[model samples]
Target: MFNLYFISQSTCSILLLLNFALKNVACNPVVRTKSGCLKGSIDRNIDGGKFYQFMGIPYAEPPVGDLRFKAPKPKHPWKGIRNATEEGSACPHRREKRFNQSVPLVGDEDCLFLNVYTAELPRNSATMKLKPVLVYIHGGGYVFGNGGRAKYGPKNLMTEDIVLVTLNYRLGILGYLSFSDPTLEIPGNAGLKDQRLALRWVQDNIRRFGGDPNRVTIDGESAGGSSVHFHVISPSCRGLFHGAIIQSGSTLNSWPWGKLDGAISVVNKIGVKAKTQKEALDVLKSLSAYELVRVLEQMGITECSNDWQDISPVIEYPHEGAFLTKSPIDILNAGEQNQVPLILGYNSKEGHWMNYQQMAAKAMGTWVAPFSWECIIPWQTGIKKGTAKSKRFADTLERTYQTETPEENVVNAWSDSIYDVGIEQAIKFHLKTHLAPIYAYRISVITRLNYLKRSLNLWDKPGVFHSDELGYLFSQSITPKVSPGSPEDIYRRRIVKLWTNFVKYKNPTPDDELNVLWQPVESVDPIKQLDIGENLTFVDTPEARRFVVWNELLEESPFIIN
Candidate 1:
């Protein structure tokens, strides 16, 4: 009898192990996309919320060889199941570094991929109710950034019942180089075209992943945010998305848009001695991706400058597949944009991250004040440098935000000119023209989760720095782990809820769970904005005095403020 019992127990153990193996096999989910079948991995959030992740899914064919400078082509159908368990290579660009550290260029030319995270999959496509979708565009000044899981993990966001998608587009010179000679066929905004293709992929395949095709919202920050606003104005992107979340960026921002002069300067700096644009195109195409990036880096080319970026969105000559043929301002002024529900805002101290070194130098008593503040005037204002108009604008800015210390004045000036003024202008225009609800906000919440500031050792510094709000919305590997019920965790939950709620209802405050009634901008006289901090409060005309100063200074300027 004892021998028999021992044999039975061993048999039961073997059966249990086999059952677990089968369960493990079941956990690897498969979803059918229009291109082919994709096998993905499963993950759990911090709170044990289970979700499915499909990574490294190609949305476009490799933009290589002859396709280098051209717009992305739609991905062709594959033969069998593609393994999407791993992330695709990042687009070709130099990795972002701190304090100007030189990092190795990482990624490949065939990097037009996207990732999808969903809490549930449709068991029966005819009966299951699809969830709303949020497609995120990463912000790296349109120079560096990818939709990989390491930085933009879905742990925080997947807890909500929504489908989240993040994607990669071409960046830097490869993405934005343009020429007036349309014969070369390298109309700029190929990166934006990549994004549009990804969105089209979502519209076609998201339903199979349990996402509603009709209820898709596009969200992005910084350059990505500006990209969203660009989509709002671009005719090519009409009907691609139903809603938008523009964080700390706007089409009105001068830095993101440029003209042919800037493009010509980049070519000249690259030592391309082409008499014609076609010759320049051939030279650029012959160079390796790494070589192009290396030359640009040696030339000190970066996404951000007081002037337009060396590589940036430009008005393309009218031709087939031209992404943007006219000025975005003209599009908005003519009310010819894709009007959609929008949630747009900026961090309280958007320039703190940009001027942290200056702040540190001042703290050490080694700071030297600039002799002339004329450089503080943004180039978008179109007021010629050293002119009376430029000097007057500079003087007014100095008087408006100048404090006893030069560091404070510098931060304020940079913040207003780079972010605040443009965002406020966007809000004003939306309120005056669009019938859709436009919710404007200013995030002033200072906490340990202020990722950018804390990473730069500026946590002790005053005000929330640019991209500080990212920590609360997405779970990144670099951020500190949040204790279950801590204030930081609560803040994270609050932010994620607000954003996902907007994704679901198009109104952040659909209910009173958070105890705040977030309202939309109704009038430009006193632009109503939600101040998101320890407590959500409705403030009338954020930084009104400073905006008034900017308004009067740029009243007669050619750049579009109205």
Candidate 2:
């Protein structure tokens, strides 16, 4: 992500006038921004109306060579105007070829680009007024994702009175490896820094795009939600955004620095070592990016399941006490994080989407694909051991998701025990420190998407599955196979209303006939689960039991213990 330096309005207007004059005063043409902008084309098909779109705007310089693992640096100022009408390249990552699904292809190392959508062209001085900003971070387990993905088109989101911003960040080995030298404090989590840089960029130039930097709301799902959790605690991210929305993912998957020893060992297998931290960093940075990815793959580093070997943020080592300090939990506990309004939540049946039984059957029956071979076994076994804790944790889970043996049971158990529980912990932490209004929900919209619904047969899993709410919340049409009668249609409307309401008012209360008031999570009887389905309900009960079981499982007997 790009480092940002904000110049005052006088400076901004002067820059604007100069840019406008350079362009010969085009019709409501958006002048190139400081990071360098290009005029966008108008599209009538988007958002039920015509909207202006600017794609592939660079937020940071490329993270290649020695800059790979360091904090993102600002892009060098451009001279002539740059073309941003087309989407920019996505970051480099190992692509997974899936059935009927075209995987997002590889692009470039300098993938810190963004796309913007607005109702109309900024009409000169009128567009300079501050409008609320909605900055979205995409989700891919911190390993795969880019803002270029079509699922996140901002046409509808932009139609509202909000400025929509979407971005891409470094992923995989390129983003999260921790170099083992004490002096090389900045080894891991360059991707997170990339996110902060993007936010900083938004703060600096969003006004030019008709957005209020101070009223920005950072939002995301899955890994992106985890990113929001990190932002809540990160000192570097303190002033970058005013509100946050974490959907379906949290920092529960995060492992402390010491837990990464195994991953560090693999990173060292390239026959490169150093006496000091700086020397170590120099040696690692010197290796080509391909060479680094190759070495991590060869050593079974990248093969490990997501939980056992984490790519999530940790307090930066060496600089842990300094530069990048505090995990989400730490910040919340100390009451030191940004105490802004929040909408943090998860799905009711988050694990059903993984389809652990099918994955395990495949892993057990065949020669695992290189990626699957390395990832499946350890991940499956890990979750099984942890699932032995509670009946609700075990029975309810296994009933919906069946496995041949105890091993598969462990895998499914670990997935929920680790992931779903993490969100619960975050909720508890937020309540401890934050006095601001907190709205939480449990996405219960069971999709008509037969594939996802069929997978739910493992047991009678309820209304929600991990990410099942995305399509609905974004108002994406349901699959033709999923019967979308009145019930399904109403479910879609409710989710869209909840999300858009949150974006507009910093709360999920919608101004419609189907509206329902949501209560803030507080010290007493803190759990608030909004069942977002054909019929919405308010569930007020403590969500701590599951948290307790899962936390214990993580502490005492991790299913995927390294």
Evaluated with lDDT, which candidate comes out highest?
1
Candidate 2, residue 512: the lDDT equals 52
Cα lDDT tens digits for candidate 1, 1-562: 2321123333433533443456545456767788877778889986997888999999999999878878999999875557789999999887754114345788999999999999877766679999999999998877788888767889999989999999999987778877776666777888999999999999999998899989999999998999999888889888889999999999888678755535556667767666677766767777788776765554553223245665778878788776777777677777888889999999887877557644444454442233246766666676677788777777777788765368756676777777888888888767656878999898989888887876787666687788889888888877887798988888889889889999999999999999999988887766778888888887653366678877877676646422
Per-candidate local distance difference test: 0.79, 0.60
lDDT tens per residue, model 2, 474-545: 423333322435565556555655666776778777455565777777742436667655567775422344
TM-score of 1: 0.91
- TM-scores of the candidates in the order shown: 0.91, 0.77
Question: Which has the greatest TM-score?
Answer: 1
